[model samples]
Target: MSLKRSLNRALAATTGLQVRKAPRPSAPPPPPAAPVYHEPAAEDRLLRRPVFVISSIRSGSTLLRMMLDTHSRLRAPHELHISRLEVGYGSSVSEYAMQNLGLERGDLEHLLWDRVLHRELVRSGKDFIVEKTPGNVFCHERIRDSWPDARFLVLLRHPESIARSWHESDPAKRPYEKAVTDVLRHVEAVDRARETLDDACTVRYEDITADPGRELRRLCRFLGLDYEPGMVDYGRKGDPELKRGLGDWRANIRTGTVQPGRALPGSGEVHPALLPYCDSWGYTS
Candidate 1:
């Protein structure tokens, strides 16, 4: 029939070669789209303008939380890990039912988080609530979506000190080398939140320990609250027991008074993995 087909048949006959069609390559499946979340209005959430402390592990957030809890109007709680709370549909019919009501999995989870925090605040009889979960830095965007009127407090510490403290917290379980890597991940997330959150107020562990009154005053101005003297003597109040799993469970925190932090690590003493972040955070000499 076709000239090329006839030539191929003649060549096949002469050389005993078989002609076979090559399989067509298939294009790869498209990547799954990222989930888009729309921010709910303030009235839809149980709590509005709640405060979140965004920080890396071993960054003195617990100390800050303890101080905030002493305030008359603020109630600071332990790490709730609300972002890890997820919702799932048990069946397709249930998923369709939820979809019909314009509720997604994230939306339901947001409502649950709001209710839990509101209950905590109501129980304490406090006007404002502060949540200081170190892991929340990773889900800061999700939190922003969940509470459009939320306020953020960015807490930073010397990256090298964070790595050392993390390793020292459990030397057997956390090797120094592994600690550096893990600490850096959190530091990067903090940087991202600081860059993106418009209402974020930043404070450093060093500043809080150096002159807590001054730092607390600055934070009060940002939070629109009056500085209470009790906040300075949080340890004397016997509130917010320093526990291991919830936060720093160390002798320094047990002292109650804001003790001066260990001297900043010298530039040469800083770990190689943490040097870049140290430079960015102004920890270098």
Candidate 2:
């Protein structure tokens, strides 16, 4: 203690100041790192916006499907025929599943529908899927309920054109009256959905084919995709298995062309019942 005190006194004498220790200076902490944003994986994007086509039968939906599928990253194949299972008192799988396994309805629906979609997307090696089932116009509501982010395209052919096609093109399978009635119902649905859903859009057969360059480019814009040249020549690159499955619509596609679908002027005989819906959807001319 004596030696330490002597050393302290000597240092103080030499310095001519107090021997109190000086505090160390501190550096400011570095600024917090900025948050990083990452884009979703392709599979996740497909889940978010599974391309579901909804349109009346014989409305040129196949053409639209093929076009979209031609995009290097898009896969629009034949009718997956997504059924509406959410309706009916006895139809809901969830109630029974809940009673038995205590599984949530949302979980069950996702497993039944979204999981199948995910598996199919993985299988096809495509980043996205566009399911083209004309009959699916009826199931539009259910599809939206299932995947809230689903992108839907509704093809609108002239009602007279659709009615005539059904009568002349598909007479063997269903009655003309049934076709007309079904078209009317589907048209009503399309109109309603167009009004309600921002993601759901209507594509006129006339517009797309008339200006494939412009309309298709516009469509690509709507889809948040870059326009691809192959989209216009989808027939050349179309899937054979899918082509055969489209019933009579395959006849035109078989020609390996993407020409505008033309019916002989006056080929269509407009029924009175279809007038209201046809007029409303902008097909009067």
Candidate 3:
């Protein structure tokens, strides 16, 4: 073979050897840059204020829940009876017996309540969780200890209206004696809660119903939330879950009942029997 031909043969062999070698697997496309989620900061979570509605039964707490639930950021649960059973007494008898037995401190704070609430909110991806637990009025201190940043809304109705409504609903089930006892208990609870919680505010049912929009706006301002006009006519809304059981007291009351006409049953004031307790809370008659 000629020298030039030999050189050409050598070049061909080198090219063939290079072609036989395995190709470097294309650099595995840079493992997808770890997903960067712009999640809310811890400070943001701490800043969130959970609104708790505390009141006695038949005091239009449902109305307040309906109103607040209309806000896009708020999630008001039906009635999470957390306070009385979890943090304080189980019932009137239990409460009375505990007092008689000199039961002072309650059980340790349970995470079950918070876990359930957090789970529900997480599943729904809701920001605000409003718990409308009527029985919580007695456990304000426990609540404060649990959620220092929580905002409380106390719903007030005329004792007469509350008692009358209770009687009308199931007179056989709720006798006048029970109704009066509940009112008295509620008054005492409210008084104690007021003294303990400076962040608490009370809303009268009459004021709420008479001018719902105004009251809702005021409530939003108090809670540091933006008021939504939709909250005003929550009963008239399309969402059935939001609309149920609101303002139903109107239908339940009997004709010529002492409660139907006035904001409160007598003189638009707290009952004379409950006056001292109301005064303790700085509540005006």
Name the best candidate (by TM-score): 1
TM-score of each: 0.85, 0.71, 0.63
In terms of TM-score, how similar is model 2 to the real structure? 0.71
Clashing pairs in 2: none
lDDT of 1 by residue, 126-205 (tens): 99999998989998988888887889999999999999999998899999999998998999999888889867999999
Q: Lowest summed lDDT over 10 consecutive residues: which window, candidate 2? A: 34-43
What Cα-based lDDT does every candidate model obtain? 0.86, 0.68, 0.63
- Score candidate 1 by lDDT: 0.86
| Per-residue lDDT of model 3, residues 1-285, tens digit only | 877677667877877422234678886666533211122324323324678877777787766776677688888766766543344446888767755644433422234455566766666567878888777787766666556577898777766677676667778887876776767877667666766776678788877767777888888988778888877655443343433343333432211111223544444544467666545544455
Quote the RMSD, in angstroms, for model 1.
8.8
Residue 161, model 2, lDDT: 76
